[model samples]
Target: MKTMNYSPEHLTSNRHLFWIAAVLGVIMMAPVAWIIGLSLKDNAELLKGTEAVFAMPYTLVNYANILESSSVFGWFINSMIVAIGQTIGVLLLSSLAGYAFARLEFPFRKTLFIIVLFGLAVPEQAVIIARHQMFNWFDLHNTHIGLILPNLSSAFGVFLMTQFFRAIPKEIDEAAMLDNASTFRIFWKVLLPLTLPAQATLGIFTFLQAWNDYWWPLISATKADMYTLTIGIASSQTNFAQSEGLGFLGAQAVFASLPVVIVYIFFQRHIVTAVSGGAVK
Candidate 1:
């Protein structure tokens, strides 16, 4: 067997890269570690600065207290409903629109596509006032439906799915059609599975956006019963003059992030692959 040799210069370069990565990793994790430490401290220990955060007498009572509070659970459920609902709605609507744009013949196809592309440049804040008025007119304010309606479609998702669908070979569509498959059958049974990576990528983005959404929900969900987790956690912090409240806020931050962290962990590979594939296409 032959042994490979690394030159002194190459070894030094590798060491530099390793140290750079280590530093970056530490920088990223520092805030998370601090939050964890803060969450463990009791109310009395919390005000003593960073030094006392990791000190003795760590307690889970902060988490317990929040969980026991009915509002937390209600907010958690509302967050889930809005996030899941918006993700599903975006996926369905974007996929259908994407497929039509990529594979179908329609009048004013270019004009319509340009219009869709125009939406990409429009900021959410630009239309928010109009959206609020529209929802109010529909009597959807202070409701979960109001929370979800604004995010039900995504321009980016439609663009992503369109690119993915366009990258797929036309032969597949022809073959399905030859077999007497209807358009919906071809889309559902043939094309859909092949676009899993794109779908997962889009789903993750849509879910995260909806989950972390605060401003829209703040304006829409005026009722306490309809508050999403982000709004609820933020509102809770106003009463955080007490040290225990600080620890509770830290705990709530960690709890709120867990779903998104788990989702990214599971779908990270697909996201990477889908993005790379799109770049190649």
Candidate 2:
């Protein structure tokens, strides 16, 4: 077979696109790079200003100090419990509700779904007082359950799964029915397995939201021991700033962000496809 060569114009266009992407990548990563440099620096080097940001004689002392003094590990555990709990709850409830809304016929189904859609526009802050009062009444304040309750099932997740389920051919359900499969059986066995991309997308979104949630946790989990990673980091950063300097804060910040970055790296492809597929629908 003969090797085909690109035209000069095509080659030039490709080169231009490559440069543009490289520029954008650098712009995005510059701050993160700076943060990493700052985190690695000693207090003496940090005091020398921006010129010394990338200078040598870096040390891991900042990381060690934060790890030693702070209850970051406890915060990490609390956050993990809340995030994973919320993600699982959202996926389970959203998938079932979504399938029902998409496939099953029930009285007031449309009206109920319309109400759920209306929930999308309701800001979380609007119900803060009510939620707080309810949680207090149930004695759930400052607890992980309280933190996970509000996020258990989001309107967006329900809507997303509903749309995706609708896109699947109804014939599949009918065929399952003919095979003596019940409604729940059809959903669990036949339909849900095909919605992996949507599920992954929703799970990632839920986990990130729960992980980074600051305001609600701030209000609910007021006790220091109950604080999530975000809240703990903010509080700890202040103490670190006063005693250990900004380098310590940078190290803690990096530590706080590692889980989210790792999650995105692994599931980024599924996220893209889920978004684009939803858009195409």
Candidate 3:
């Protein structure tokens, strides 16, 4: 057995790092805390000034108003549908493409992967006009499919899944082959289960991206009935300049973020594992 000792200087360095991290954490959380505080305060009080956030007499009127709004509820449902739809699509397509790219031999495989990677460099704005025109031609506008379709073929998802799949040992596949397991079976039963961490990471990111997406939904879902949470929330803001509804705006921000927070709470362990590159054990 081996023993290790930490010197006074090492301890001092660790202490400094702890304080630095604590300060940075506080800096990052300050805006979130401010928003939450504002959401609890009265709109009129907030109109007087943001200083009311630090005072007493907090209320839930803002949240009450949000809950009572039927349009907000519809928007929330739209967001959920789009986010879940897109996440599942991205995961399925990306995993299949990744498995093919990593494990199968096919002509133009490398070239095709290179082209897909090129998509990562191409900003969405560059092709937005063409995409919109095509979608218009297909009459996909103002539809849930319109919002979900654009993100289904995810280049980043493909890249991440491919790398994760490649990191897995090929011997597993070879052994499965010896047992006459079909390719789809090998992938579905043997390999896919091992990639749970990567799937969790990809699913979380895809859901978050779809949930927060505003620009595409803003243009595509022009109708109020079709609006996602982001567009709906923005449209609900009666006035931004005068802070006419400051507390409501704050509440919307907080309300919209609750889903993401809940998701993190449920999957934080898998997220940590994926980030630490432990997907392959």
TM-score for each prediction? 0.93, 0.91, 0.93
- Please provide, for model 2 over 3-82, each residue's C-alpha lDDT reduced to its tens digit, 9 standing for 90 to 100: 76799998999999999999999999999998898898887666657567766778999899877865878898899999
**Model with the higher TM-score, candidate 1 or 2:** 1
Segments of candidate 1 deviating more than 4 angstroms: 1-5, 48-50, 274-281
Displacement of residue 208 (Cα, Å) in model 3 is 1.3
Evaluate model 3: give its lDDT: 0.91
lDDT of 2: 0.88
Instruction: List candidate 3 stretches off by more than 4 Å.
Output: 238-244
* Model 3, span 166-270: residue lDDT tens: 999999999999999999999999999988888988998899899999889988999999999899889867665364378888888898999999999999887
**Rank list by lDDT:** 3, 2, 1
Assess each prediction's global lDDT (C-alpha) against the native: 0.87, 0.88, 0.91
| Clash count in backbone of candidate 1 | 0
Worst 10 residues of 3 by lDDT: 236-245
Clashing pairs in 2: none
- How badly does each model clash, as a count of residue pairs? 0, 0, 0
